[model samples]
Structure formats: structure tokens, C-alpha cells
Target: MFGLTFEKLLLIGVIAAFLIGPDKLPHYAQQLGKLVRNMRDYANGAKDRVRDEMGPEFDDVDWQKLDPRQYDPRRIIRDALTDEPEAAPAAPSPNPNSAYLQHRAKQQALATGELPPFDNEAT
Candidate 1:
């Protein structure tokens, strides 16, 4: 396959047959076939083992999402630079009279670079 056509393959085969000699060509071909078969079997066995370990959820996995070919470094960097930061989650409702609410409000103001209001009598 490797961009090689039938004629190219035939040429390679002729050269190989000549180099390897006709008597040994069949033996080498048989070895190559066995190697290919073994590789395929190994790959299939690995898949089967993974399926057994992960159960049905293995089949539900998004294979294309996991493919490395889809990853583009430039696109990823562009998105990182261009995308806005996610909005913060809503704060929990606090008791109106709780000291925790007062402290939280002060923290929020400080985080925003503003000075918290100081009540002389409350302090």
C-alpha cells in the first residue's frame, strides 16, 4: 500500500525473488504471513481483554474523541487565548444575620481590590 501500485509491487516482488532465490521465497512469504497473523491476533486479544475488564461501558466510549489525529496544537492554543473565562458559580444563600455573611462580604470586597466598610461601633 504505502503509495505503491500493482506494478511497483510486482517489481519489488521480482527483485526480492531474484535476491532471495526462488527456493527460499515461499518460506519467507510463509513467515511474513505468520507474522502478520500474529500481530492481528495480538491486537484483537488486547481489545478483548480491555472489553472484558471494562464491561459494556468500553463499547460506549467515544473513540473519535480519543483519537490523537484530531488534536491540533494551534487550534487548542487559539481557543485558550480567545475563549472567555467561565462564570463563577453562584454563592450559597447565607443567613442574613450571620457573622459568616459579613466576613464573606468583606472577603469579596477585598478580592475586588476595594476596601471593606469599617463601622466603628460594630468593631
Candidate 2:
């Protein structure tokens, strides 16, 4: 189909006839016809094979279901993601107090490093 037109082909044929003369045009045409026939047969056979193997299910299936160009892969993945819950934003650290509490902790540990009587040792 290659955008071939009757006028363009006729032009090509006129040139071929002049260049190759009346001796080989018929032979080339026959060969071209055979090539086209073989291509059509191959395509038909492939289609028949798929239809036979897939059976009624294939026939009944919506054609759009098989069209890769029209499929939305994201829809399936998005559905799967939506099925899971967002982890409750990590429970904020048990101790929300920062700088002051952290410093007090360090001081407590240091003052009681090797002693048991240290709950009131810092004072």
C-alpha cells in the first residue's frame, strides 16, 4: 500500500518498459503476484491459528480488551495500592519533649553510672 497510486505505478511501468523492454515485464509481474499471494496466505493462516486456539472465549471477548494501545496498566496498579491502608503516620515518638528531656536523661545516666542509690543522687 506504501502510498502507491495508479498514476505513480503507471509511470514506473512506462520507465521499466523503456529500460527493460517488453521482454521481462510479464515475468516480473507474475513474480510480484505470487509474492502478494503468499503474504496474504501467511496472514490468513496466522489469524486462523489464533482464532482456533483461543476458541469461543476469544471470539466472545471484547476486542478492546486485547488492544495494548487502549489498555490502562495504571488502573490495575492503582486499584491494588488503594486496597491497602496508609500506615497510620508512624505513632509520633513516645517522648515528644526533645532538648530538655534529652539533656536530663544524659545527666541522670552519668550521675548514676555505677551506683544504685542514684534516683535522688543528682540533687
Could you give the C-alpha RMSD of every candidate to the true structure, in order shown? 14.7, 17.7
Candidate 1, pairs of clashing residues: none
- How would you encode candidate 1's per-residue C-alpha lDDT over 1-123 as one tens digit per residue? 689999999999999999999899999999999999999999999999999999999989999999989886544543454444333225633543443344346553356676778998984
Model 1 Cα displacement at 37 (Å)? 1.0
TM-score of 2: 0.49
RMSD of 2: 17.7
The CA lDDT of each predicted structure is 0.74, 0.69
lDDT of 2 by residue, 12-74 (tens): 989988887788889888998999999999999999999999987767888877788974444
* TM-scores vs. true structure, each candidate: 0.59, 0.49
Q: Which prediction has the highest TM-score against the true structure?
A: 1
Per-residue lDDT, model 1, residue 59, is: 87
